[model samples]
Target: MKYPNGTKMIKSNYKDNFTSKQSFGNRGMTLEEDINATNNYYVETDRAIIHKKPTPVQIVNVNYPKRSAAVITEGYFKQASTTDYNGIYRNKYIDFEAKVTKNKTLFPLANIHEHQIKHMESITRHGGISFIVIRFALYNETYFLQGEKLFSYWNDKLKGGRKSIPYQAIKEEGFFIPFHYQARVNYLSIIDKLYF
Candidate 1:
């Protein structure tokens, strides 16, 4: 090829046809983002209505440098958030918390709060579907752990037992959620099998 300046471009020996192996992973997308996309897809298709619960924040100060622009200078959480998400699926109330951990061997119980556990318990008691979406980022795998199973582990930890749930145990007991193009975190499928 010739340049506009009348200079000849030299061709290098780099392979132009080389292709890298395609990976079926989430590709740097966070667990929340994946779940949000999945929820969007569900809402768009009239499959279910789910959304990320916004944390209650008390905006103490706001700076309005310009009329069109406002910046939140100070804010505080009004209350502790119960869970990450809640919605209705197949006429049943769905509530869950989404957590991502880098640990490969186990999921630390410290990541969850006590109040959240109580809330989840209440949800289950009220005939609602309650669960947690745990993502092992190291393995690129997500699992749906039921509230009842989680409560047992929490109780064990409180009773001077293991502080974390083993990844192998979760694999055996929890349901794995596979990634899809539209439903990146297809957790609804697990609900379908277990609930409906």
Candidate 2:
């Protein structure tokens, strides 16, 4: 019997092409893009319905050069945005904010507004799922931190504690999310583990 020659059968360029394609997959994708893609996948697969909440803006002036091209020259925020996204997953209300930071050591507390904290607090109080998705851009790592856990840090900061959560702390407390083909962020998997 003739033995199969694996080395001779494999294409030389296959490894190069595969690695290049894998590297290209996450090239220049912002946190928003990843979440949006994940949300779209969730919706498409009948897993969940989630979307990025639009910022509330009031247009003060508009310039129209053509019927199809109208530009808002001036606008003001109607109110402070509560969070980045909210939706229902597995019959539970899901509310979260997504933040991307270039900081290497810590995530600045200032990145999260007081009002947003209150909003997340309210969601938790009402038995809803609330959390924040923090992405450390330098390391290209995404973490899922529960709102309940975040509240302790916020309270500490208010009481003369560190102004930022150390990267080490997050690595300990937060769930590290792995990227996937369909669910780019795949945060729902974390939710499933935590809630379900």
On TM-score, the leading prediction is 1
User: What TM-score goes with each of the models?
Assistant: 0.84, 0.83
RMSD from true fold, candidate 2 = 12.8
Q: Can you tell me which runs of candidate 1 are displaced by over 4 Å?
A: 1-22, 77-79
lDDT (C-alpha) at residue 66 in model 2: 68
Question: Which candidate leads the pack in lDDT?
Answer: 1
Task: Count backbone clashes in candidate 1.
Answer: 0
| Candidate 2 residue lDDT tens string, 47-103 | 999899887889999999865789888887676558889899999999999987878
lDDT digits (tens) for residues 66-142 of candidate 1:
65789978987665658889999889999999997878799999999999999999999999999999988777789
C-alpha positional error of residue 155 in candidate 2 after TM-score superposition, expressed in Å:
0.2
lDDT of 1 at 50: 97
